[model samples]
Target: MKNIIINFSVMIALLASCSPATEKKVDKKADSTEVKVNAIPAPSPENNTVLKSYIPVDLSTLVPIDVLNTKSTDVYEKYGIEFSGNCYSCDLASLSITKDTMIWTNVCDENDTFKIDDFSYSTEGSKTIVKTSERTYIITQIDKAPIYELVVEGKKLELNNKRVSRYFTTKKALSLFKEHDCGDFEG
Candidate 1:
């Protein structure tokens, strides 16, 4: 009976040592020994790099204008314009102009036709002449640096430098407009 008791005690001690609580502690210690890795930051551009690129314009602050009427202050309200090229990709395009400034936005992309909206062009030195919906004129004395932004699938991507031109290709531009049935403006 003494031997039996001794054996039972040993078994009980072994079982206790192997309990779930003890196993969990061992697991926690193992987890703590694991190393966590973080992502590295992207490298900055070289100091000598030159950047020149067109950015999409913001149009919320300006009023729309008829590209045809140079004298009227009447704002032109339309859905948007489509512009597609190897250089730009967007879904919609719009133009809004005030006395001195213009704002624009690109809304969608079909094949290559990227939509632009809220686009503004300076009418200060430019003369607006009545033209068809497809043909309108805003002759600027000096081409200004226009700001532009791109939205793709609800994700906004900005093209800040001309060096990024390599990312856009003619094939992609044609695909954008071709998908939308917009005439091949690139040709």
Candidate 2:
């Protein structure tokens, strides 16, 4: 019994030493604060970055007024953002979702406005990812609405996520923005 136990212990020790430690590499770029682990470098989109990039704003007041996950609003009711036009001040996109149909329109008056590509969206947990046939749109929640940070695929457009830069006050945008504004919109 003692010999058998000793042999088993020796075998376990040998096996432990023979196993290789899995190495995990974490690389963080100073520019974009995203930390990727053992990341495979994606072919950089000619006009876009792989991760969501935003201008850092003082959001101290915004958080208190933000409706992160409110009871009064549902996912479908929230409008998704669209950024187009070669200029940073492009017009916003609009979505009208009904029981049977979904409509997305580029509302900018500029002819240079970037258009939302033919894409579909699905929710991965609370985050909704909008993807075109070629690339995925950078979708994130801002003021309770889905904002897409995209690099106009074919154009030299610099489109910024409007939620952090300015307030979206369209009728549909207002419906959801009011929920977090803590203003007179109680419905």
The top-ranked prediction according to lDDT is 2
- The local lDDT score (0 to 100) that residue 17 gets in candidate 2 is 64
- What lDDT tens digits, residue by residue, belong to model 1 across residues 1-187? 9999999999999899789788999888777655221222222232112211121222222211112333543222111122342224433333333333333333232232223343333222222221222433333212121112221222333422211111111222223222323345543
Candidate 1, run of 10 with poorest lDDT: 162-171
Tell me the spans in candidate 2 whose CA falls farther than 4 Å from its real position.
1-92, 95-104, 108-120, 145-170, 173-187
TM-score of 2: 0.26
* Steric overlap count per candidate: 44, 3
The whole-model C-alpha lDDT of candidate 1 against the native structure comes to 0.31
TM-score of each: 0.21, 0.26
Q: After superposition, how far is residue 130 of candidate 1 from its true place, in Å?
A: 31
| Candidate with maximal TM-score | 2
lDDT of each: 0.31, 0.36
